[model samples]
Structure formats: structure tokens, C-alpha cells
Target: MDAFIGAYLGVLTLPNVSDLDGELLIHVGVGRTVGIWRARHPGDARALFLFRSELGYHHHGVPRQKELLRGAFAGMHAHAHRWVYELDRTPAFYFDSITQLRMDRTSLG
Candidate 1:
């Protein structure tokens, strides 16, 4: 964690970041990660599509848009859009972890 933080802050001397295969949870509203991502992928239609898809996924089939949006984006350590790659094929892969995490957090609190 410290190494990744140092690398993100540009205060660490490290090799290629490409070798790191793990995911990093980032807050979209704060810090430089969003800017860095945008800068690195200017005019990328794929990124735009991904953002729209995530937005649509979380709010789809819901009438209470306000509450749904609040639950999706607010009161979390990491506030960002979450995308599950497989919606129809293998939803359990994503929801299982999501359920466990929510349960763990609720229990912890």
C-alpha cells in the first residue's frame, strides 16, 4: 500500500507500473487519478461508453433515482462508478463479493 501510494505521489523510485496487476480503488471526486486517466486517454470513446454503462447499470429499472443514486455514490470511502463486466452471463462473480463486503461493513459498524 505504501509502495503504491509512493508511486502515485511520484516520490518513489520504482520500475514499470505495468507489472502491477492488482486493482486500485480510487475516489473519483478527489485526487489526481481522474485527471491522469483522462489525460492518458484523450478522446477515447471506450472510456465514455464505460462511464455511461456504469451509470446506467446502477440506476436501471429503478424509479427512485435520487435514493438509488445516493446509495450508489454517497457515504463510502471510495466514491466512484462500479462496473460489473458480466451482467447476464456471470453476475454472481461481482454480486457475491459485493454482498460479502456490504455484510462485513454492516457487521463491523
Candidate 2:
């Protein structure tokens, strides 16, 4: 897992991250394996959380926006999008929008 995180961060490091606010958050993990990681890192928050399982996965926070999540993952070769939104006590509506935008951007090469 250390290597995976390191590689993931290394990829992110090369990108131009001028903003790190309520933007999209992308995470890749194996099916239910993400839950385990999330359990260990409870402090982390995401607007959109995409979990990929052999059978399928779940999209929490926003139900109607599942299509957007699928579109975001369409091009990726990975299992799913593990998006984390930092609400910071903010409302759910606002955070959901922010998460979608971040997910959209992260999907682009």
C-alpha cells in the first residue's frame, strides 16, 4: 500500500495543482478494499466516493449524479474513483457540486 500511495502521489506531483480546495478528488482502489483504507484514514473527506468491486460498487453522498461518476470513470483503466470531499462543516449540496467538478478534471489526461 505504501508503494501504491507513493506512486499515486508521485503522479499527482507532476500535475499543476494551483488549487486544492473543494475541487474533485480521485482515488483508485480494488473494490471493497477502499473501505479498509478509508477506515484507517478517517480524517479524509471527499465529495464523491466511487468504489469498484468485481460485481459493482457504490456512490455515496449523491445518488442522482451516478451517471457523472460513471462518465468520469469511462476512460480510466482502473477499477473506480475514490473521491474525497472536504466539507469542513459546509452544506452537502455545495460540496457535491465541488466534488463533481474535481472528479471531471481528474479524469482528463
Candidate 3:
């Protein structure tokens, strides 16, 4: 995972990010990637990822990460976007829920 994250970080420039956003709907899975990044490179992940407050909604102290995960599924139905990247090894339930969002086995090269 560290190696993957390191390679991704190597190419994670602002212009590349913009191009990625233009092509696909991306969502960070509520998992160890952020924690690992924070531990490995403190203060850097904060700049790259968005927080709950940035989404312009008040959670009233409820855990917002859970809401964000739920919202990812909700947004799939509410919106017409066909692609979403759950930036982790996605689980089976995800595949069961959304049939169209298949895993792309093609290389990034």
C-alpha cells in the first residue's frame, strides 16, 4: 500500500488531479490510506484531500466520515455519474450495490 501510495503521490500534481476529476468521480475510502499518509507525511494529506467542513454541511457532532461513505452510495443513485473510485480494495457489497462500476484491470500506463 505504501508503495502504491508513493507512486500515486509522485504523479499527484494539481493538473493531473484536475484531469482525473474531469474523467472520473473519485472518493477516498474511509480507511487507512489517510492515516498512513498522515503518519508517513504529516501535514501533506490535509492539502490533498477534502474534509467534511469543506463540503459545506454541519454534522452536529455526528461522525461525518460515515456520512460521507453513505453519501457516496446515495449520490450514485441521485446523480447520473457512472464512475466512482473508492480508493481502496473495495468490498463485495459495493459490487453488489452498483453493477456498472466494475473494476478496471487495465494498467495505468
Candidate 4:
């Protein structure tokens, strides 16, 4: 964790970002829809969240109008932290951790 943080802060001696992965907080409009997912490549072994956006009947993989952060879209950590602050201010909605969606593959057939 420290190594990744150092790299992000540009304080590391070497730009060694091994094992560092970026994730996303997908939102369509406001409370209408929300979900989380990790960026993936086709050559990757598999994915934790095989996310696909649903627009009435249309389904898509990636989000449009993205604001890049850390070589990818903004991560879940930043979004989650902001959500906490907003909750404290307005207390409008509820949030929960859905940890059941493990990002690692542990099953074998």
C-alpha cells in the first residue's frame, strides 16, 4: 500500500507500480443507478465485477464522459469518502459495503 501511495504521490525512487490496479464508481445520473467495478483487459484471467450498464434495453461495458484519475477513472475509495461527507451533511441516502463481490478468483473446477 505504501509503495502504491508513493508512486501516486510521485515521491517514490522508482516508478514501480507493480500489482497496482484501478477501480471505478459507476453512476448514471443520481440515485437512479449506482454500482462499482474494476477496470479490466481482455487478456486478464478473469474479473471480479463483470459489469455492464443497462439503459432500459441497451447494455454497454464502459462509461462515457469519464474524468481520468490515476491513469483510469476515479476510484471507489475517493467516491466512498465523498459519500461519507455528503451523508454527514444532508443525510439523504444510505450506503452499505457489498463485500460479497470478491475481486479475486478462489474457485477451481
Best by TM-score: 2
If scored against the real structure, what TM-score would every candidate get? Answer: 0.18, 0.24, 0.18, 0.18
lDDT of 4 by residue, 23-92 (tens): 5344442222233332244222111121122222222221221111112222444543242222223312
Model 1 agreement with the true structure over 1-109: per-residue lDDT tens digits: 1111111111111222222233333345322221112212232111111111122233233234323333443443332222211122221211100111123243554
Q: Which candidate has the top score in lDDT?
A: 2
Give the range where candidate 4 is weakest over 10 consecutive residues by summed lDDT. Answer: 5-14
Query: Worst ten-residue run, lDDT, model 2?
Result: 6-15
Sorted on lDDT, best first, the list reads 2, 3, 4, 1
As for model 4, its CA RMSD to the true structure in angstroms is 17.7
lDDT, model 4? 0.25
RMSD of 2: 15.6
List the candidate 4 regions with Cα displacement exceeding 4 Å.
Answer: 1-24, 27-76, 95-109
Q: After superposition, how far is residue 19 of candidate 1 from its true place, in Å?
A: 23
Indicate the TM-score of model 3. 0.18
Backbone clashes in model 4, listed as residue pairs = none
Question: Global CA lDDT of candidate 2, please?
Answer: 0.29
Could you tally the backbone clashes for each prediction?
0, 9, 0, 0
Each prediction's RMSD to truth? 15.2, 15.6, 17.7, 17.7
Displacement of the residue 39 alpha carbon in candidate 3, Å:
0.7
